[model samples]
Target: MSKKILITDDALFMRVTLKNILVANGYEVVGEATNGQEAVDKYDAHQPDLVLMDITMPIMDGITATRTIKGKHPAANVVMCTAMGQKNMVIEAIQAGAKDFIVKPFQPERVLESIKKLIG
Candidate 1:
């Protein structure tokens, strides 16, 4: 079965773009969120196979949400999405239990590779 994924980004365009990539690559987008808090809520509700989360967002940041979710579900698979030049935040995110990360200006191949690496 296709892996279920939850995509969280502050920008609607980013979410749409990521969704398109996942759908085209044979994955199912179970839900979407515009911020970290919503990501956590949707995560709990959907219990998706993986979460593609942005590092910066309103309400809460991805690192905090990642930590919260992992605290509750140690097996949760979270991949942080960041822009270039946010290495420190990316490190923090990984420490918060993110499995991996994808830098923005999204690349379909890299996204798929990351997802496959995690889900497979």
Candidate 2:
């Protein structure tokens, strides 16, 4: 079976871009969240194999959500999405229990690579 994924980003365009890439690659996108709090809720609801989370979001930030999810579910797999100049936040995301990261203006290969490496 194809692995399930949850995509969380404040920008609708980003989420759509990620969904397009993932779906084309045969990864099943189970849910989408517009903010960190929603991401956490969706994570609990879906129990997806992986999460692609954006770092700077309203309501809550991705790093904090990753920390919350990992705190409750140590095995939860999270991959942070960061833009240029968000290097420090990416590091923070990793420390907070993200499995890996993908930089925005993402390459489809990188997204697939991280998900495959983490879950497959």
Candidate 3:
């Protein structure tokens, strides 16, 4: 069976782009969340194999969401996606238990590489 994935981003365009990429690569997108809180909720409902999360979202940020999800499900697989490639953010994300990080305006290959490394 195809691996289930949950996508979380505030921007509609980003979510669509990610969905297209993931779908084309044969990953099943089980849920999409517009913010970190929604991502948390969807994660519980879907229990997806992976979560693609964005930072700087309203309601909650990706780092907080990743931390929350990881706190609840220790084995949950989360990858941080954001335009901010700042050192602090990356460090915080990794400390929050994100398995990998992908910067925005990403290459499809890079995204796939990160996902494949974690889930495949």
Candidate 4:
């Protein structure tokens, strides 16, 4: 069966782009969240195999959401997808239980590579 994925980003464009990429690559997109809070909530509803999360969002940031999800579901897989590439941010995301970090404006291959490593 195709793996289910949840995409979380405040930007509609980012969500759309990610959805397209995942769908075209034979993965299922189970949910989309406009913010971190929604991401956490949808995760419970969807029980996706992975979450593509963005940092620097209104409401709650991706790191916090990742941490929350990890706390609740220790086996949850989260990958940070953001424009922020700072060392500190990457470290924080890793500490928050993100399995991988991909800087925004990313190549489709890079995104798929990360997801594949986790769920494929």
lDDT of 2 by residue, 6-120 (tens): 9999999999999999999889999999999999999999999999999999999999999999988999999999998998898899999998999989999898889889998
TM-score of each: 0.98, 0.98, 0.97, 0.97
Error of 2 at 71 (Å): 0.9
The CA-based lDDT of model 1 is what?
Answer: 0.96
Q: How do the residues 1-120 of candidate 4 rate in per-residue lDDT, one tens digit apiece?
A: 999999999999999999998999999999999899999999999999999999889999999999999999999999998685466887899999999988888689999999999999
The models' CA-based lDDT, in order, is 0.96, 0.94, 0.94, 0.93
lDDT tens digits, residues 63-83, model 3?
999999999999999999978
Model 3 regions more than 4 Å off: none
Error of 3 at 38 (Å): 0.3
Better of 3 and 4 by lDDT: 3
lDDT of 2: 0.94
- Model 4, residue 61: distance off in Å is 0.5
Error of 4 at 10 (Å): 0.3
Which wins on lDDT, candidate 1 or candidate 4? 1
